[model samples]
Target: MKGIQSTGPALLMLAILILAPAFAEPAPNTIKIVCTTSVLMDPATYIGGDRVEAITIADPTLCPHLQGDIIPSRIQLNMDFIPGADLFMAYNDSNDQRYNIPAVNDFMKANNYGSVTWKTVSDPSREWNTPAKAKLLAEEVRGWLVQYDPINESYYDERYGEYVKSFDAIEPTPAEKEKLNQTQVIVMLWQREPVEEWLGMNVVNIFAPEFALNGTRTAAKVVDDINANPEKYRNVSFIIENMQSGELAKGIEESLKDKGINVKRVVFTNFPRSIEGVDTMAEVLEHNKQIVL
Candidate 1:
């Protein structure tokens, strides 16, 4: 009887041990991805599928480039999360949307957590703001996921195919392409340069904001250019603005319409419109297409 009682408890304990993992959250062997910016997290989530746990150094609520401005408190919080990451992906838009990672690296060093070798992407042929670039980056992300978790290679590729197809629908239609081909545009901000190529529009000039020109005579002289040669800027059907640089639009609106230029003054967000939306790249790109077209 004592043998039976002892064995009964042991068997029960054994059963509990075996069942514990079945009810556990997040299965073992899941890849941990740490993205330098939240904008990159969208694509990483899609490509990682359910096998990845993604952490973004930059949160979705902030602007893309502003990710570098995360406060000291947030940095300490990240110290708890980043040490376990298996892969680190960083975007290298040194000209337009640079990210600062030295602080993150230093934290890892202080905590004795090894610093991950970062994989970077600088889209030299096309900028990251457009759908085409998003599609290209998705492929790169898929490759990274596959490299780390080769067992789920097929799964990642399947998700990537769907992601690419979704963006394919966002491309300009034939008629829209023809219209864009004929129209010339002047974007007031340097960050908006990709819109010109993405929409097939001729970008005559991309004006960089000289902060010194705020309410200065130089600003007036530039405004005079739009007023004096309305015909020269007639084909300028879109005065696309950066969401970050609303000041550039200050006095240009009246001059742009001196000849009834009828331009669509559009604003573009550098980051995903909604971070929680799993298909953020598709949603943001499609939103831009609907507005621009």
Candidate 2:
């Protein structure tokens, strides 16, 4: 009975000390992770886990090109959500070089924050048009994820490997393969970049219009080509990216309607609003299945 004296108060005090760190909030200088788009944010969260907080500036539905000029407002917003962001993740590429990169760079420079360019981080090479390129990009993304959390390097590697596997899983069904063989889809992209090349390689019977943007000359050329060989290209479809070709879709849709040539559905590459957890390219493609090649 000598050992059973009252240690309850002392134990309670010790317990309080042990749980004090948990109860105390994180410091103002804690590391914060910011991404350019919600799509980019998804993978960041998966990789960062609880170690870092993630934030996105662009609305998932709005095109990054059209994010508008509210720099002061954005700065305030960033300050509020990510007071201690250590790094920024951007997804701007050569296609977006004209607008996205400048805007993101300006913002970071003005705010004096560190940033990692997605294009630089991903380092897309000439193989972007091949399945090998897709695998490479996936691996690059995995590498970035692991860089932030070295402890979970193996986990990130496995996740990215799964992503690559899923992308390769997209084999055309018999009907799709038949369509692929018979139909010569001309992917009229709004932007002239590796995306068209990538699509052309994977979709096989696909071709890109001479011009990537929607203009009177390009539109007329497309119409002329179709008219010249209507019998051969009747089943042909057009795929447009929402980011750059939103206006093109309207123009082409109208132009085709006026000429009585009913083009197939106009698929948007990126959505009109911000959607959470759309990390992988496969996920982006699957999300827009209605416009799949």
Candidate 3:
């Protein structure tokens, strides 16, 4: 997966100069952005408005873990799009060990073109619990949104402040707070490494199929929790970092059903893309709220 380094700064400057007019006219304001997956691309699109030019690498339904064959068309697309990109976003973490990230990283390094940033959508602190990890990852995304769209800093700060206040308001009502806490979820991750931190250093709730497909005691506990009371826990969620097909999702659903528990809500959080949009952080937060709530 080795990649050649990008054209040096002089060539990059030359390329930028050549592309500057194209951008200055009407399209440059629309920053070209590339995402590793569609889950990330969609939300970015909502926030970017018309200013971003985005490209997604992994389709929503493909398994990123198994994406070994890099299409020539995609490579050519990246060559064409990345040179003109204002920002490049990628999910670089231990969990992506299965993907061809080295090649991707090499390409970005060689280009030295855009403001590249890495996002670990999964919580690295926690082991395998999906609910707590998803919440943490959501918070991380808020920060990324702020960084990506700094023009709306004040608005994003205010909206985030209000969101926190709303969460606090619910705390005063014990019954309501309990209800929020009872919103149990189960995340079926594509891998277990990246989310270790999000699950907390001490917490360990996942079981890899390679080691023991059925899961360990910690995972069993979560399964028990879901089985203990499914009615009370209406919102069960899972964040699949690695790309998975609809059939895999169905398999997870059926597995839960076998335990007399069914998943109520599901959200896809990762994807691939080419363009970058320019929207406020507030907008991104609002979109996340809609997906989760």
Candidate 4:
């Protein structure tokens, strides 16, 4: 009888232990933030740490303007996080106002959810792919996190410093810069900032979508330019393409190949998850750098 009683209590305690995790609630004061994209979500997560739950609307690969049907579907999928989201974050760019914000607003209104705070973390017009811009972005995220949760200001500051250090760690060495300066590249307009400005590569030319510059700078046009003046781009060893912008360089590659000019084509992405195992902005920088190096 004594053994039975002792074992019964032990078994009951074991059951409780097993079930505890399933029933546990999130820590008190853990604010939930819903961001427009991974660019914003990544920093919010790093700075906020355990004090905030950050979720994003679009996959890192898809830009806000191209989200189309993805917007409503993502809102529905993240309904659990939406209801309790304390803040709605975005870059306040035209795309967010046109696509992400309107769709999110409609969902909340239709569902009769209460208003959530909205914050624009950075200027949307600035290119954020470069290390300098990424550091600025991390600082902005830390500022917002401290404002949102003053109790954890010290923790947020520490995380922000660590995030900045990651960018510093990946900066190109002087020797790498010297080599990059000598390597000539033809790149996509969207990727030129990092390839030309950040990496210090000599960009011979740039190509963009048909809509950009009224089709004057399309890939077809680049092919024509290469054909018309082969010597101008003769030294170009790499053709860098933006993953989001589609394969605009295929025609360029073929044209160059036919002219007996061979160049390596490398695709770069501005967002995380666009490349497997690249989950943060710093990783994105290093990933793109390794491609050219």
Candidate 5:
């Protein structure tokens, strides 16, 4: 009788414990990533697919590289947002968004918030914004996921392979040869050689601030860039303002216009987003293609 009584009670307890989880809500397995620059937003999404949720803090409408002192509003980016992430990455190349990095790293050190420590990782290389660079970003994202969630490596690899294949299939319009009305090149506040190659344009340049603040590029070394008398400087057809730095682009256009070079103007976003309904990394490139052509 005593054995039966004890055994029955134990069995009841095991049943309750086993059934408890079924009644309780299951935790979600999706990864959460926060990217500081708009440039990184689409790449994370393209590589992560359904497995990830990414938020970008930077704007596609303004310069991502604004000096902290020059832009007071940007210093207020909420640090609290970093704690909820599975991964946090900020672009260190171009304007690199360096001012925001310290705040993120400090929050990580204090909270140890995510699975990985975010050091000052930057790509000064031209690959950061172009589709050609996206393949590399996808590979990196897969490696990070596999390292942290080994069970999902196959899943991650499968998706990434699909992503890379599409990039391989892309056929940008062939390089333009004639430099008739001064050839056109995409301007990035500076040269983005990759974007130039992607657009098949002949030249690209970034605006030096001395022109904006001091009222002209004539005193600036950019003077040589405008002097088409030299063959190397001839093909700069227009100014394609980086999304973040359109103000700079407008100012540069005016400055250049003042100097007799009438450059065509277009705006380019650094990443994919809601604009023109573009939601995919590949679509982002396609959007640029449409814009450049």
Candidate 6:
């Protein structure tokens, strides 16, 4: 009788403990932030830590300008959380102005929800893939968090310092740089900065979308240039493609391979979660390095 009595109470206590979480309320003062892209979400997540709930609307794998069927579906799925969001953030670039913002607005309006008053976190149309930009983004996110929740300023500042420390650890070592410097690469226009300038690789040529700068060579044009002037890319061993920009270097890779030049192609994503297990800006940088190195 005594064993049964003691065991019954213990079992009840264990059950109550397990079920407590299911009935628990969210932490007080938890601010919900709606970010248009993972570029903003990644930093917000790291800097905000447990204090903020950050969410992204767009598919990081696709460019902001290209509104495929996925964007609409995502907005619909996130509609539940959209209404009570404390803050809305975006790049506010031409792409966001045209597609992302409108998609969000149209959805909100149709549902009778007011227009989103977005906080701009990035320069218009600027890329956020590089390490330098990533650091700047962390600062931007920290600043925004502090401004929004001044009471948690110290907490955000501490988290920002920790994030920057983690970022600094991923900086390529001199030996890694030497290896990168020895390799010749062909890269997408958006990926050129990280590959050539940051990684210290010898960039043989760059290919871009047809709508890029008037003088910039499109992928097809790059292939033509490569064939016309083989010497320029004779040593090119790798083609770095941008995931958001589509496979702009496919023709270039195929052409090089057809000409008996073996070149490896690697795609890099600017946003977290676009690649498996790459959930943060530092991991994104590390992921890019691991694939190429």
Better of 3 and 5 by TM-score: 5
Q: Name the candidate that leads on TM-score.
A: 4
Model 2 has how many clashing residue pairs? 5
Candidate 4 least-lDDT 10 residues = 114-123
Error of 5 at 24 (Å): 12
* TM-score for each predicted model, relative to the true structure: 0.76, 0.64, 0.44, 0.88, 0.67, 0.87
lDDT by residue (tens digit), candidate 2, 1-293: 44555677778889999999988975434337666665556555554445557777665655555556643356557765543565666655543465544655666667776554443445522323234555665566566666755766776666666656766765446665454454334444432233344333222122233443344446556556555655544444553444433444344445445566565645545431333554555555555442454
Error of 5 at 111 (Å): 7.4
Once fitted onto the true fold, the runs of candidate 2 whose alpha carbons sit more than 4 angstroms away are 3-31, 68-75, 81-83, 95-98, 108-119, 122-134, 165-175, 190-217, 227-232, 237-244, 250-262, 271-280, 290-293
Q: What's the count of clashing pairs in each model shown? A: 0, 5, 42, 0, 6, 0
What lDDT is reached at residue 44 by model 4?
88
TM-score of candidate 4 relative to the true fold = 0.88
Local accuracy of candidate 6 as per-residue lDDT tens digits, 68-122: 5678898888988888888888888777777777888898889888877888866
Where does model 3 exceed 4 Å of error? 1-28, 71-73, 95-100, 108-149, 152-293
> Compared to the true structure, candidate 1 yields what TM-score?
0.76
- Model 5 off-target regions past 4 Å? 1-28, 67-81, 94-97, 107-116, 119-126, 174-183, 189-191, 204-206, 211-237, 249-263, 274-276
User: What is candidate 5's CA lDDT for residue 95?
Assistant: 56
Give a tens-digit lDDT track for model 5, residues 1-293.
99999999999999999999888977557787777665566656666778888776665555556545433244235455556677776656545446556545555666665444652243445455566776777666667767767876787788778878876565463443232113566366443554565555655455545535365432234544555433443345667655654455565465466666656777666566637686666776666666655
Measured with C-alpha atoms, the lDDT of residue 215 in candidate 3 is 47
Q: Residue pairs in steric clash, candidate 6? A: none
Whole-model Cα lDDT per candidate? 0.68, 0.52, 0.46, 0.87, 0.60, 0.84
Q: Which ranking of candidates, highest TM-score first?
A: 4, 6, 1, 5, 2, 3
lDDT by residue for model 1 (1-293), tens: 99999999999999999999888885557777877666678788877777777877765555445455563346677765678778888775552234446656777788788775887775634556777777878778888888878877898999889878887877788998897778777665544555666777787555545652363423355577776666778777766666644446545656777667776667655567443453477777666666666
Tens digits of lDDT, candidate 4, 199-288: 999999999888778989999898889889999988889999988767879989888888888798998899876778999999999999
